[model samples]
Target: MAAAAAPKSNAPHIPVLLRPLIAAVAPVQGVWLDGTLGAGGYARALLDAGADQVIGVDRDPLAHDMAQGWGAEYGDRLRLVLGNFAQMDDYATDLDGVVLDLGVSSMQLDLAERGFSFMKDGPLDMRMSQEGPSAADLVNTAEESDLADILYLYGEERASRRIARAIVKARTEAPIETTLHLAGLIERCLPRSKPGQAHAATRSFQAIRIAVNDEYGALIAGLEAAERALKEGGQLAVVTFHSIEDRIVKRFLTARSGGGGTGSRHAPEITREEPQFTLKSRKAIGPDDEELAVNPRARSARLRVATRTDAPAGQSERSALGVPMLKGAK
Candidate 1:
């Protein structure tokens, strides 16, 4: 597959933690999977790194369109799928390696109509799939208590009750249908900061987007699917941009690494299982100063990787692990 010309954008979509990810996954000539094909950044990299073929999965139709332009250069080596990565098992067959870069892309946040940002004015829509109920629907229609819980749990906002009360009060008069209106409401409820602090709307917007997109839930399901899909000795590398998402990935990798858990010690050791995946690094990797200077978005990024142990191929089963059935359409 030949490389294509870079997209005509002010800043190119630079895949985060590229060096560490490539080193850990060690992509070879095989069927590779890019679970979150945002702007086709990592997908292009994998092909360039000598991957024989790649299956790129994304929920956004616009992403599929952009990938089509890229596929023209790769010829039959690229297969683009318009769907969520959470159901990766449904599409992936004979996978060698998988890479998942979670959270919203810079392109989505910059696009006003996508409604992923609190910095810019746009509609209240925050559906990553562009088909589900938006942030506006959740804020306007959900009960006050439920809304408060979502902000508190997903957003980690200390003044969740106050924010929920403010939202309910404003929506009673008129629907909170725009990004700026909601950001303004959140800012009003927050106490004035001393100095050198971010806007109060940052956390609220993050929380609402998480709730609207079911991001945490999707991450859990996607990880389980990736685990099940990998062949023994295959690798899974994930890059997360938020603390909440990182925590989930950390816990999952830790559990799989046999770092102590509540399971019976007498029963078969978890690490001895057929589909075991060993941690490639003790701690999550972060970008160096050079990358951070060029792309500020790299600051919050964290990468975790694991390699599938050498066990009998095609003998692993998800039923043995009893992974929870995921909610929502993939």
Candidate 2:
């Protein structure tokens, strides 16, 4: 389940914050891994930026197929693997760097047949690996409370209970099987979006997609995997799209890099482990106006880059990172 890529591809998918990411991790070289590999934008950039080799890892089979069109030019320089980035440590130890772009790719979202977007009409299948219980199954079978928790916790949607109730009632009438079908039901429970706002079903769809794909779990595991895989001085750069995701990445880096302040007398300053990483910057980097003009998706994207150290790698508290978990610990 490992992959590498060539210097180029017909990847129309724009790599958001490409300039900023490259700038933040300047002098990119050695062996790098593109964990997301959605259209191979980051892989190509890293290869072009003088990485001796680039390993492109992605769980989606379609990504591998897409890479085939242009991956051969780099030959051994570009290796493409088929697997979740959560196991990135197993792909290659001592990697010079790891790049992860979280959430659904533009390619996946644009294609209605993939079902990642409620804006489009397609099957209720949002599994990134194209395997496992689909969104349709989750909607049709998961308990009402679970659905409510998913929307409220994972998505931060306030109307989760009402929408969950509606979903349970609607499915009883008939199985919720399509993107539009489910979106339509949720829309009825919410107010219409204004001219400048997002669609009514945006948050609900995001929550379900996150649940169906285990995105947050994969994200935390992937960060840990990056820590375990990177060599001393190697970098880990992540680009997140939402507040929750940004918060998780920010907290993970802060904790691992020893950014947490000393505790008071009542708490007693506990001895801390050797720092695993050093933050490139205290604040996340974002796209400039030029990049934003070219890619509006870059608006919400935040880049957080840090370099791994020789310290032993360990897990960060999940609650500290704000990873939303289901009630039954399912």
Question: What are the Cα lDDT values of the candidates?
Answer: 0.80, 0.88
The most accurate candidate by TM-score is 2
Candidate 1 — what's its lDDT? 0.80
Predicted structure with the largest lDDT when compared to the true one: 2
Per-residue accuracy of model 1 over 208-299 as CA lDDT, tens digit each = 88888888767877887887788777788999897878878887776565553557767765545443678998899999998898888798
Candidate 1 versus truth, CA RMSD in Å, comes to 5.1
Q: Please list the residue runs of candidate 2 whose C-alpha ends up more than 4 Å from where it truly belongs after superposition.
A: 1-11
Among all windows of 10 consecutive residues in model 2, the one with the lowest summed lDDT is 1-10
Q: For model 1, what is the error of residue 51's alpha carbon versus the real structure, in angstroms, after optimal superposition?
A: 0.5
Q: What TM-score would every model get versus the actual structure? A: 0.88, 0.95
Judged by whole-model lDDT over C-alpha atoms, candidate 2 comes out at 0.88
